[model samples]
Target: MLVGNRVILVTGAARGIGQATAVFLAASGAQVIIHGRSEESMDETVRLIQSAEGLEPLRVAYDVRDEAGMKLAFKQIKKIFGRLDGLVNNAGIMTEGLMGMVKTTHIQEMLDVNVTSVILHMQLSSRLMLKNKQGSIVNVSSIIGTRGSEGSAAYAASKAAVIGATLSASKEWAGKGVRVNAVAPGFIETDLTAHYMENKKEKLLETIKMNRFGHVEEVASVISFLLSDMSSYITGQVIGVDGGMVI
Candidate 1:
């Protein structure tokens, strides 16, 4: 109940880690907002949350890279919730290819989704959060961002940028009671990573010290902690849910 009555928005929440986070946040008593690129996706997420006895999270849709869409989404948020207490910038995309072989458009798309959209969300969300003079934000980063990986150059760069943004935002807003941090997940089992699980299953397992892929709930728990008062003193940190891969 740490987040009871708190208004929290989770983007890219139609499925996968985003959906798990939304469910956890709602279960923790937040007035959760579920966002996705389509209504069908958000609807499914809402059903899942409701089935779990969690609050019926608001369903919002937006193209992460579109500034206008984000603005309108926030407008709707204010109208419904009146204030924003927490935000999870979990919306992102991954395009795998060799650094040299990756097209310019592909890299740009990755940056636009994983990095630029995050900044835009922070800007729009922070304005509402700052009004209350207290808020928390959790950016979903990736292990690739810190350690690098084959065929993930652009994705790595984008996630790395997320860490940098989290750091800077924490410093810039901490004094005003806003905390920003990030969770760097490693080899999570989600639709996004289904291809990897299929194509590089054993090799990926070998790399994980835990000898297993992470569950979305594991990462979601950490995110909930970071967004709650439990981690009030923590900010500008990139905590890895990577099963000791870094070790």
Candidate 2:
């Protein structure tokens, strides 16, 4: 395994892509720390990873936007793992609204969770990674961010900011051994998107080249690669895991 013995922390891992990434990384032999807002939800993620890989992930519960709590998380991570090797900034929220009708608070909420939190997580995690001189950060963006969606202005803007942050962060750490990248996933089948997918099935399928909602594991595969040595020379890249949805 390319990441054996490495310590990787994945935020927003209670379910969906975050959960899948945590499980996949554990299966790939990396020691994973699952972060989310609830201990119960994180426990379920740990249980799933244990069932699939026979290895349980360490759990860290905190709102990614909570700076003080996150500082404590990093301390705890260092206390337990000694070093941070990888960080997956997968925590975000999706809000839907026409740009003209979107409420101010709704847009702010989207930006806070999807963009601000990612920057804070990357900043704090990279500080720890700098000591080790090598690390990788993978942010989760969306196809809407790249192609613009009609009723998803806030969500698109937030995700677009993720791409911007990823680019600047990569340049900041370019020759310092810390790599930053992002995965812009298309319509993925998960509890959070299940309702929307079901409601817009016919319309959604028409836009996807693959004609199917992506599985969490499929997106997880790309995230796992970015966090591993297999992508050693890759940085400042946004790999779309949307089955060519944007194409």
Candidate 3:
């Protein structure tokens, strides 16, 4: 019960790590705002979380990149919860190809979804958190953000930006008592990575020292720690839940 009375907003909460984190937080007694792009997916996640013995999180649907829609959703959040204690920026997209071969639109879309939206959400959420003098912001970065990988320049770049943002924001807001941190997860067995590792299993395994893909719960546990008082003195840090891959 790390988040006994907190209100949290998790983006991309329909499935994969986002869904897992929402359930993890809810089970710990957080009032979670399960956000996703589709209403059906959000509803399913709500049901799944409740069935798992977690609290019934509020289902909210909004594309992270939709500024107008995001603003409206925030207004609704203020009206409903009156306050927010944490935020998990888990919504992201990957665009992979030779850097030069990637189209302009592809690059822009990835940047908008993965980088720009995160900054916007942090800015908005920070305003709400500042009032309380206590809040946690966890941005889901990737191990690739620190290590350059072939054919994933855009994705890596966006994640790298997330790390940069986390560090800067954490420092700037530390005095105000709002902790900002990032979780750089390694290759995890989730739907997002299925497309990349479908047939390149051997190559992916060769890169990891553990030689095994990580589970969603492994990442969620670290996130829960960050959101809890257990990590009171930690901020501006990138906790890599990567099975010792980059250590």
Candidate 4:
């Protein structure tokens, strides 16, 4: 419910679910650290948060795939905020391709950005959280990771890896007061998913029990809940934000 005064970091906060989550968390009173590939990309997100009269957010720009950049970003957070209370691993890339036809470059990029970076960030963030003996982390996954889709084999593999990491990390740090969980969204209407919405809207709708694609705010709300005390007892679980698509 409330994350007031908590210091949180949201990666890929320039757009889509990441942007929405950063805005929502800022509005809810968290001191949000907005991260993007470049400071210019975060302008709109920063503007929206400021317009809401939320706390002034800290801005960090770095490629999630770059280890040195990520380390520097964390160091900046530590120097500025003194402690990290929450982390949302919302930065990821999804490149769709069928198994045999998928480009090797696409697969590697997905693994590096979606899976590798997530684990590294988790590692860095958990250390900061452990010092405080309490913290929360939320990773953005997708339904495709759980139930494979036709043209997303490699993408699915990357997200599936996230789910696995969340489970393992939760167990590793739960006793030390760090909680890790993931949100597996279905058909969310974000820029990343615009292609599917444009090409297969009706067909995708038929599969979801709710008969609708989700909105960015819908997923953001769940991420906020996971970061707050409302989900204090929840960890190591992959909460589906899908419209009953998997069922």
Q: Please report how far candidate 2 places residue 79 from its true position, in Å.
A: 1.3
Query: What lDDT score goes with residue 129 in model 3?
Result: 92
- Ranked by lDDT, the better of candidates 1 and 3 is 1
Q: How close to the true structure is residue 190 of candidate 1, measured as C-alpha lDDT?
A: 92
**Local accuracy of candidate 4 as per-residue lDDT tens digits, 108-225:** 9999999999999999998899999999999998999988899899999999999999999999998999999999999898889777644578878889999888999999999999
TM-score, model 4 to reference: 0.98
Q: Is candidate 1 or candidate 4 better by TM-score?
A: 4
Q: In angstroms, how far off is 40's CA in candidate 2?
A: 0.8
Candidate 2 runs further than 4 Å off? 197-199
C-alpha RMSD by candidate, in order: 1.2, 1.3, 1.3, 1.0
Q: Order the candidates by lDDT, highest first — what do you get?
A: 4, 1, 3, 2
* Candidate of highest TM-score: 4
Task: Give the best candidate by lDDT.
Answer: 4
Candidate 1 lDDT by residue in tens digits, 76-192: 999988899999999999999997899999999999999999998999998998888989999999999998998889999999999999999999998999999999999889999
Candidate 1 segments whose C-alpha is farther than 4 A from its true place: 197-199
Could you tell which candidate, 2 or 3, scores higher by lDDT? 3
lDDT of 2 by residue, 148-205 (tens): 8889888989999999999999999979999999998988998768768455777888
For each candidate, the alpha-carbon lDDT, in order, equals: 0.90, 0.88, 0.89, 0.94
lDDT of 3 at 150: 85
